[model samples]
Target: MPLMNWDSSLDVGVDKMNDEHQQILSLMNHIYDAREAGRSGPDVIALVDRLGQVTIDHFRDEEAYMEQIGYAGIASHKLIHKDLLDKFTGYASDIKGSGGQVPEKFLTFLKLWLTAHIRGIDMKYSPKADLLKAG
Candidate 1:
């Protein structure tokens, strides 16, 4: 089973952003699977790097979309993204430095971050986008 499953409940009502979010969830699952399969070291490191890149790309796209739509909370939203990115980067670096044994703490952190961010932050934008789409 995948670590993180994407569903409509996670959608923000923006097609592009929703797609990016799904991709991120898929990447998270991949990482979890790798860990569970006892595949660490360079393989895990590579997966972490890919996750980092995808995260950065998704955040940039989301921020750009917010800007285009003149979302009032864009600044705060970007800051949240930055904080999350920093956390993820730290995790990746720590794993790489440790020769690829990802700490249990890091896995827990990922799960918590994904759950909170998706349910709280991401969902907050959904209503507005849905209204726009309906119009």
Candidate 2:
């Protein structure tokens, strides 16, 4: 099972946001491991649910930070967050309906989404914030 490693590059220069991101990554790894081990059921479903909740909470914190710092892309960032939440919610519902048997497709999707989203969208906001702090 491929694990999501927390790297400095994933940091958005916001301590709280970065910490939350780390937690999300950790939970993703846990879920991935459980899925790979064929341990599907309430255990996996509970992990997915927890990940979804953490994701929502992290997004909220990030949005609030964007507002505080007058981030120019706040609207687009929020849209991305909403889209992610929708996708996560759909995945959770599907797992619950399936009695917690998550398909391999879902695992692949989660890995790809987390990797790409953090590297792309999250990193985009980091430099500016870092610069602000440096100054």
The prediction achieving the highest TM-score against the true structure is: 1
lDDT of 1 by residue, 1-135 (tens): 877777766767788887887887888788888888888889888888998899899888888887887778888888999999989989999999988787878878877887788777876666565565576
lDDT of 2 by residue, 23-131 (tens): 9988888988887788888999999999998998888988888888777888999999888889888889999998888787877878778778877787667755566
Off by over 4 Å in 2: 128-135
Against the true structure, what is each candidate's TM-score?
0.89, 0.88
Worst 10 residues of 2 by lDDT: 124-133
